[model samples]
Target: MFTRCWLWIGRLLRRTLLITLSAGLASGAIGYCYYSLKFSGPVSAEEQIPATEAADSRAIIEDAIRVVEQHRSDTRVLRDAHAKAHGCVKAEVSVLSELPSNLSYGVFSQPGKTWQAWMRLSNGNAYPQFDRARDARGMAIKLLEVEGEKLLGSRSEQDFVMFNHPSFFVRDVAEYRQNFAAQANGQQVLAFLPGWDPRHWEVRHLLIALQTLSPAPETPLASTYNSIAPFKLGPIASKYRVIPSPENCPSYTPPAQNRDLPNFLRNALYQQLSIDRVDACFALQVQLQDPTHFMPIEDPSVEWDEALAPFVTVAKIRVAAQDFDSREQNLFCDNLAFNPWQALPEHRPLGGINRLRKEVYEAVNVYRHQRNQQSQTP
Candidate 1:
């Protein structure tokens, strides 16, 4: 009996050692390949170029349209190929005063600037998906009737889109193209493999980041949304985060009896809005430095370290009390088109991901409108 136990322990130890050795070798090889592709020198402010060229932008846009073409054919449902709205609510964005000079740009220039905004919250899936599934949540805001020269020619509205996570799964449009290509082909494993590879250190780093994830949130108000990608703040670059105001904030108190609801998240928001008004705020944070190395303006995968420059409250958002859950309101949300490109030039989005978004969003609108037979309006 003693001899048998000794043999069993020896075999287990050997197995563990073999597994560890294999993992180390795989990691080392992956690291070597990852480092091979890196640039040795730092990018200076002068050296910094626009995130995307016209050619690349066109290519990314075409790729996105082609990929979604199959999806449109398959579903025949009127929806954005990305986030499909499950909830829509109205809000007021009250611009705060006495901000630092650097922060006082574009929309924040005036102390008392205010706009009537519509908030369209959605599940980050192509269809009206089950709410209990683990997926990213989207917050699309359209700040209306603001007097300004806008990016979406002759329009005065500023549109902002956000996700629950702070960093993107892919760093740029090229990386995302491959992932989306794989997705369109119904071979999502292709996208998953590169991130899983031991050789792709940058991707591994993104994998380790909390921002590349979205846990199932109990309610839209309870979950925080991040702009993940940066935007040009006058001459500076920055990101945004939105959360519920501390006073009478929405919560996640689930009843003991109801555990298996398919649409819990949507239901949760409706219940709260049904009772009374909801309030929330948006915090604008600036990027401290160009950070030539890791935290570059071009990389959406790298999280800007908050330790360098903490965020300041440059703006506050207030959601008005209303029956936002009604069918009429939901349909209203569907008709609206929201994009970061629909903004003032000062707040123009900056980054490869954002550049990709410019074209992808347009393509999405075209596809969505064609499918739904809705009027194509900018």
Candidate 2:
């Protein structure tokens, strides 16, 4: 009886060891796959595969329109992305009095040249939400009286559209189409979640999206903004950024609690401009693309290393003291359309993503204006 019991115990111990080993191996495999998908291998800028454009570009743009329509159908007010405007202020974008030869490109070519412009600050939501909510922010500067032909409309206006974040989440047109399709089909969650299929996983993009929509700044003008994608800086490719002039802009003091203040961001802007009567200023800077793989032309998700290629201040954007939240001003801002494609030839938007934007933005602009019964231009 004792011998039989010993043999049974040994068999049970052996089975338990095997099960433990199997579980460990399975966990290890899952971890390896997760890391591999989250952080991809290095890609050379020259060797990066160009996304195929044969897939119907029109369909992609239509999908974007449909998504926006469905998103705002309940409210019956159709607005494009970044639909809510905090305020549109009158401003000026003046080139630096002295600029380096390499930095003198496009709008920055003529030193000390100032252009009358409208600076629209906005929260990056498809529909207006509480301003205190953590979301991406936008700074769109439309410079009027710019000479020469434009890539889009016949207007002599040039728009510099930027987001507070330095890099975008989508890598290319293909990925952009996928995102629109997912939103249109009401399966937007799938863009981030990896269900049973690993191929549909977008862990990296989801991480980036979270970073993009981080906490809102104390004020819109207080935060820096970036183009994220590349554009033509004369013969070379580059990105642009607008840094807040801290010395000129006042420091913000938040309330002890903000659960009651939904529009605190807009209020901060108002207090700074109308109440305090301070001039807000920013340094418009440019960063040229590196010759190697570090600063990619295709992937907007990959932030160009500032340590490798630092941004050079090319111009100054100044907003004088004014009450920009008037009803008439808000109405005018609502009608305004700021498109990146509405640019001078020398500063044409580059990369497959921007090419898609040229089409998407145009279609969305027309559709939105027609729905609102307003002119496409402000």
Task: Count residue pairs with overlapping backbones in model 2.
Answer: 0
Clashing pairs in 2: none
Residue-wise C-alpha lDDT for candidate 2, range 41-63, written one tens digit per residue:
34333324354753646778767
Q: Which candidate is the best by TM-score?
A: 2
Deviating ranges (above 4 Å) for candidate 1: 1-8, 11-59, 66-77, 192-213, 248-259, 276-293, 376-378
Weakest lDDT window of 10 consecutive positions for candidate 2:
40-49
True lDDT of residue 122, candidate 2: 92
Indicate the TM-score of model 2: 0.83
Q: What is the TM-score of each candidate against the true structure?
A: 0.82, 0.83
Task: Give one digit per residue, the lDDT tens place, for model 1 in 141-210.
Answer: 8888878788878777888888788777776666666666666678644564665665553444346333
Candidate 1 vs. true structure, TM-score: 0.82
For model 2 the local lDDT of residue 241 reads 93
